[model samples]
Target: MKCTAVLAALAAIAITPVNGGPIAYGICQTGCNAVVVACYAAAGFQFGTVIAAAAAPATILACNAALGTCSATCATVALFAPIP
Candidate 1:
């Protein structure tokens, strides 16, 4: 159990962004609101007003590449992973 806990913590740390690191927001401002919206939409969340509320940050992050905000090598793994 101790080992499992340690591993989990390490995994979390691995995914966390580094200070001064560049994270792509895909053409949106800080926090990548636009990319988050698109990601949510592509994930099939497009519907009513709730869509905006639901897909805000996530969509922005998804579109980070387009925005040229995130680093290609570092953000690649985290960006592709399912929303947390």
Candidate 2:
């Protein structure tokens, strides 16, 4: 269960687009790393609680913003979630 959650979080991070250009992508990656770290720090190595408490909000926000604000095609590219 924990492994599955971690894998899903990793997959989500892989798909999310950074806010800016290449540099922004790097920063976003760093931010994602921080988030992951925070989750682990708070929840220990249990992937389900960590990911649910941390990544879910960020992911949902990104997905919603991408869907509502972006153009249709752009939203499709930006928030390509497996579940939504």
TM-score of each: 0.22, 0.31
Residue-level lDDT tens digits of model 2 in 1-84:
132343346446665443323433333344444554455445345333433535455554444344333233323332433321
Residues 1-84 of candidate 1: C-alpha lDDT, one tens digit per residue: 122233335446655544322232121133334444565577566523443534456654444444344233224433333222
Least accurate stretch of 10 residues (summed lDDT) in model 1? 19-28
Q: How many clashing residue pairs are found in candidate 2? A: 0
Clash count list over all predictions: 16, 0
- Number of the top-ranking candidate, with TM-score as the measure: 2
Question: Whole-model Cα lDDT per candidate?
Answer: 0.39, 0.40
What lDDT score is found at residue 70 in candidate 2? 28
